[model samples]
Target: MKKHLTFLILLILTAATGYGQSATSDADSKIVTFRFQPGKDMFVLKGNETELTRLYSLVDEYHGRITAGELPIRVDGYCASRATEKANLHTAYLRANRVKSELITQKGLKEGDFVTANYATAYNGDKDVVVVTLRIPVKKETAVVKEEPKTETRTETKPEPQPTVKEQPAAPVTEPVTETVPETPAPVRPYHFAVRTNVLYDAMLLPTLGVEWRINTDLGVKLDGSLAWWGGEHGKTMKVWLLNPEVRWYLLHDKRFYAGVSGSYGEYNIYKYMVGNILSKDTGYQGSLWSAGLTVGYQLYLSRSFSVDFNLGLGYVRSEYDSFGMTNGVRVYKDRDKTKNFWGPTQVGINLIWTIGGHK
Candidate 1:
């Protein structure tokens, strides 16, 4: 009994050693691994590269071997946990597909040569990797058949008739019903034209008219003109004409506050009625001024179609003046001519605005 037990133990040890050696050899020969950086669209071949070359070289060598042996291949893809399982699955699928595409296109492999699978946050334990494996076909063992001598025996039995039950009818079928859905309306854009009058200038009877064209919610341009003429007995006469054009950029989408620049050109005439208490007909100085300025302002919307705008301007003005006197209502030019240059507040406006075609 002792001799038989010792022989059985030796046989078991030998078998275990042989199985371990076989498993190690199979692991070394069958599997090749490469690591990948997480959250990247492209695969890096150098992740498990050797010095001065890449594991990509090993892939090429394996490709040649596969082509020679006509072996099947598999690509397994994995991704770390994403916000949702579907996202992880999709990412892993995309990575596997990308690898398969590169293998077919760049490595000159046939599209039919590879199959892909996405592990999806599994197998890698929360790390991202793509594994390319060459599949080894399993060999099936042949079964041995044992032959035996044939003998025959026969027995006779009588057939009997059986009664059958009738089948019941199925229930009536109903069509599926679909629910109606309401349609959504399209969005409206805010664009329009507004006409505004400067009421402050109206106090001076200097009717000022402004037209603003708002191309968008936050950008606009305005053109304004003011004209007035006054004449009295003692040769007291004044005439003024002004043209101002400005570009406005609203700071808010609602167009509450804005800053812009303007260019203005104006001409005015001031006449003195009497020269030394005697009516000299018309003695006056006519001057023309041009200015360019920076402006800042705010608008208070009173209603859907009405608003008030208050703006201030400061800039440099250049003016040229010519003196003249009139005899028999005809103008006569004087020898005195002057030019002036000054910089200060150039404009103040309080305007009442009415929107014509703009949105609220």
Candidate 2:
């Protein structure tokens, strides 16, 4: 058993050594290395230990990122981590060099400039990768001077004196001329005329006739008359007549249409006769009647010089008799008291008109 254990131990040790050598050889052949930082103005060539040490020192002082002077730095490109054992130093260096070239050429920066850089780490499989960034500075320029402009001075010239001539006496001033114009006569407008027939709805009242004349478009005058005949108990027949005059005011004054109201006083006359009887003879009575009222109506134009008018009115009526007398061979008895008559709750009536004049 001891002999077998010794042989096995020797075999295991040889195999382990061979495996280790193979692993080391493969790593050396397949993997490459490089150094970068987040901020840098220049790139170090791959496998250049001297440049790598310089970059590392700069990166360490700036703490993985730096902005020295006016330059800006940042890390870019693909990477796994900073601690990558199998990093592609060649590709990393190429990328860094491109960044530096871009800053110098495209960004208008000087070559070999020391600029702040930023650094980062990434991992690819089991490899750590490092990146560097750098910013270029911008320079300011001074402005150029402008020359002052020269101005020219101008000289003034005086006018020459004119020769004097002997003056003749001035002619007498002429009077201003005036023009004469003919005056135009004013236009003439025709007058308006209206007539109305009014009959009370109640049986005791009489029908009335009214006429109106417009003195002007805004003012007018009215005249009215009424007549009635009545037969009562004891074979008595009565006749009555009333006349009224009024002044009117037009409320609206449009050319073709108008409306107005009027105030008027009425005069009435009555004649009455009674048949004969045994105790009293045929008797007669005569009186003057009075009435007062307001009227309102409108006028409509049928032509330039003619128009139609309509009106309605309400008023009170009263009759007074001086004395009573007998007639037609009848005996009569006269009372000492005089007779007075008053009638009306209201009076309403309308008028139709035919205007003759007053044209606008």
Candidate 3:
């Protein structure tokens, strides 16, 4: 009985050793990770494009190995805990799938070659991230070694006593752990072209329209036109059309303050004018005028695509006109080809601006 028990014990020990030696080796993996802002599926271009491009380059480098099942790729998506579970899941899904699609479509990799997961915890427990990992697995062949059987003796063994470790008191923290935040790139804005009309002109039954071409981020060119045409009725008649063009230099990043120079030209006709005088003759003036000025403006944004612009100009004006006076309900010229030059406030506008096109 004792001999049989010894043989069983040795057989069990040998089997256990062989089983432990039968192994699959896994190599360390390389990873590329990019993070998103809260409630955002896409990472900011300025921050994550480098890592994403690198990941694509790596995919290209490992294309053959990956297709042959030698190097496997895995993509995992995670979201910040700021939204409901369903929303988060959807965002994570988009993030993962978009990246995979880029690899498949742009890099010419097969979709089936990747193992993709959505809404997973990222490395270091980051809440919002997409991680791509590449791993190489090594398979080892089994080798059998034969040895002569040796005699063995069983001895009673006792476990070594684990040394008692004294718990160290944690040091008091002096400063709060502050997370470093990446600088946000400006979102899409009005790239070019803005249309506008003046509220005061509309109120006065005058038609005013303005167009702006944003030359660049800090500069713009604007053209404005207005008309106040009224039919001749009794002693009152007025007709006018004005064209103004300006170039602006925006002083604020939000396009709030702008200072620039502008030029204006107009033709005007008015019949009969009096300062509440019964004896004063009703006189009329018809002329063409031109003005140039320095303009300063303030813009208040109502939405991403709308703003209110208030601008004022101070400048010089020159005009040529023919003066007419009413005589027995007939027109009589008092002065002809008269020229006048003046300097004062030339333009004022309270404009409603609609920025055209999509955000940048």
Judging by TM-score against the true structure, name the best candidate.
Answer: 3
Against the reference, the lDDT scores of all candidates come to: 0.69, 0.47, 0.74
Write candidate 2's Cα lDDT for 150-224 as tens digits.
444444464654444444544555568685332222223335676555534123456677777777656777777
- lDDT for position 311 in model 3: 95
Model 1 regions lying over 4 Å from their true place: 1-191, 272-284, 323-335
Candidate number achieving the greatest lDDT relative to the actual structure: 3
Candidate 3 lDDT over 1-360, as tens digits, reads: 999999999999999888765542445467898777877775455688789788867776667777666677898888755557777778888778767755653454566778888874444778878888987554454464544345354444656544444444455445675864423232223447899998876766568999999876678899999888775446566677889999999885445689999999999777642211222447778889999999999987555478799999999999999888877767789899999999998888899999885342
Against the hidden true structure, what lDDT does model 2 obtain?
Answer: 0.47
Which residue pairs in candidate 3 have backbone atoms (N, alpha carbon, C) closer than 3 angstroms, thus clashing?
A: 188-360, 189-360
Whole-model lDDT, model 3 = 0.74
Off by over 4 Å in 3: 1-191, 272-281, 358-360
lDDT of 2 at 222: 78
Q: What's the CA error at residue 157 for candidate 3, in Å?
A: 29
